[model samples]
Target: MRKIKKICFYVLLGVIGIPSYAQDYSISLLPFSTDNYDEFSPAYYRGDIVFCSNQKSTIFIDYTDEKENLPPLNMYRVEEVERNVWGKAELFSKQFKSNANEGPATFNSTGSEIYFTRNNNNKKKIGNFIDKNNRLGIYYSKFNRRSNEWSEPTPFKYNNPAYNFAHPSLSEDENYLYFVSDMEGGYGGTDLYVCKLENGNWGAPQNLGPNINTTGNEYFPFIHSTGRLYFSSDEHGSIGRLDIFYSEKVNVEWHKPIHMDAPINSRYNDFGLIIDAFKKSGMFCSDRQRTSDDIYAFTPLYPMFENSQRQEENDYCYVLYEDGAENPDPSLFEYEWTFGDGNKARGLEVEHCFNGPGDYTLELNVIDKLTGEVSYTQAIYPLKIEDIAQVYINAPDTVEVGQEVVFDGRKTNITDFDIYRYYWDFGDGRKTRGIEATHFYTIRGNYIVQLGVVSREDKEGNSEKRGVYKNIVVVGSLKERGRRTSD
Candidate 1:
């Protein structure tokens, strides 16, 4: 009982290291993440999220906690209305939501079988009792879609009342079950363990080894469809508390786990990570607000590329054109290239130089010379051509009306070319010429500001005109900050 009492405090440890890689994703609170109570460990199935909660305000308002004054964590499901919006959460099932604890569930690919955590209790026989306290154990339930009801739960074959076994994650093929437990000879308080599902029977559980099981707790294991193992740990270097980490299987071995950097791994307890089937986005649990646990969702803004296999870049800009066809002969395809810098070439491979610095559109037209079929592709290739002038403008995107605003171009890159002229268009019928200019807006509206630069040192009438545009918003002025004095 003393060891079980310490389980709740396992999430409070905060000393750890941060991941070296940068986080290229954005995260926000799920709309249903309530401030009144705790919600965590979200498992996505189809369009719904099956999660754990201990709050009384949930749809299961009638579910009275049987574990003294402490609310028993129970499983609930919510329908995702949109990307970040979710409908009200409901008890997974009235009958399944027992007085005892039940939560942290996972479903198979078919969604017909579920593995969940529950207290060890058997109404029929004393032989099932590993000890008198009835510690945690794993349970399985089958869903009869035809009847729309879950079958009676059966205890996992390896569940022992003397120890704790929870947080199950199934492999893609459902051939292996990964879970967290405090079984004997583990690396720490609780370590991740896995058991194989062979011939309708679960084999002996095996520890995931030292690479994963640290001297601290590791829990909430999730296996992404891409075969990545994601879990939370307090021992591994973390931003704080329990940060999420993931490791990929390479050469039949698990690599060292990589920290999931923020805004995913904040200075808070973050765990229960499950990526969407598409692997583009997913959800996680965090107690960052210091109020109550909440669920957060994240999505990547760019394509995820392997860090070790990134293409090396040279000093000069270059483009590669591929046939992009299956097993086509190079001689059968003709290439037409447009550098978008007033340069064009026709060949399978050709290099061109730009005379100025700006964003350039490179187009490649591939023609099947044999069938006369043609296809084309284009991509924007930015170039900072050496000895060319580049202009950068800095201005507040929005400001109060009647406020004076400054537009500065001191950071502009004019490394090689000599600037002949600088022109500014304030979009309100006002024009000026200078490297830096200031203006005041009296009306509340949106204005487009344009900067045009003419640069060429040696030749007259050979100056190149480069223009940049930005939108500025003017709003009504705000009142001064409120001040209070002690009475």
Candidate 2:
């Protein structure tokens, strides 16, 4: 028998500052998630998702006793309806479906292998009635590419016939497996454990230690690609029954977990977090609505720079340029456009472009279509406009060869830029850098004069360069040109 070890976990209730790279995520409940029954524990398998739900199952008869209305949890797969939205749900594996519970599964990198939690179906009868042996345990299955089906589940090595072991999450490399178990040698009602896969065999399960496991249950251990572990714990300070928390691995050890906070978490059971590869967006399960647990997708609200920060190189603001010809469209109701630069317009549709790139307050004063009351709403809109250096040459197009032609580069205009260097290439093996230059063409012919300007503003090498070329016809002296024309 394993020795039971108990350790105390001190919960920290204060909120910590979020990291700069961390995102302010917005949550939206998936459309397919129902209101009555429970649907939770979403895991990504390739592009689709596999989750646990207690929805109506044809194979299993609803168990009515202490638990009513809620059916046995089973694994179901939902395809993408359009982008993040999902389609109808269906049984993930027909062969693995049983009268017992099945749920909370994960797939290996290639998605060729899967591990799931299900109640032990093999039971013993005590009397005239049958014992279903409802203890949950992890199960394994393999996919056959040719047949397009999943193999019958086989009990995992760590699964026990008595104690419960469920909620399996795999590392990206599939070298370490994390799960929730209530077996002996845990700190609380349930604790998280990890087992290493060595030489094609899983080693002995090791407890995640006191930093993560607590006197209360810790469920749904998901290891992100960044080695950060996410789980739900009733032991830590939570807004409600259970809240999602994540801890990063430092110095080869797990640190104290931190609560995910509001929006992602709420005053209800929120758990089962699954992040994408980049860790920018993903989905999770929450019962914050007071209904059953439903799945929600989250994405970060990025700064104004959707692509690059260089203002002039990118389009900072889009000019809607609407005349409000279409009325009562609802979308155009209370139409007003206030370009942050103090320029305002009123109509069903209007357009405004920022004068230059800088921080501005774009206020939209919309009048109530029916009430005629005005409300000004403003948001911080950062605009950047590229100030391009331009060179305009003002010189005579035709000049006598012996005449002194003055080339001026002072006409170059660089908005919000200081011209540091001006270059002139006379196309006559002569080049000079200055605002103005005098050149005498001794030979009569068509000469292409080029002007190049360079402007530098800061030490960071934020510079702009622009060039212009002009064709000049330098005729010979009047008498020499007349002699050539008469011949």
What TM-score goes with each of the models?
0.59, 0.57
Predicted model with the maximum TM-score: 1
lDDT of 2: 0.70
lDDT measured at residue 481 in model 2 versus the true structure, 0 to 100: 64
**Candidate 2 per-residue C-alpha lDDT over 1-487 given as tens digits, one digit per residue, 9 for 90 to 100:** 0001101122323443333222347878987688887788899987888888778867455452232434456688899977876788998877766655677898899999999877675332221111224566798999999999888778989787667778899999999999988889899988999999999999999999999998888888899876778999876776666789987654346767777856787666678999887766888887777677898998754222112111122234566434333344464356666666777777634656665556665545555666766643422244545434446676888988656678986655566567777777676544555788877665667987777666765799666666777788987778776888999
Q: What is the TM-score of candidate 1? A: 0.59
Query: Could you tell me the lDDT of residue 485 within candidate 2?
Result: 92
Q: Per-residue lDDT for 330 in model 2?
A: 60
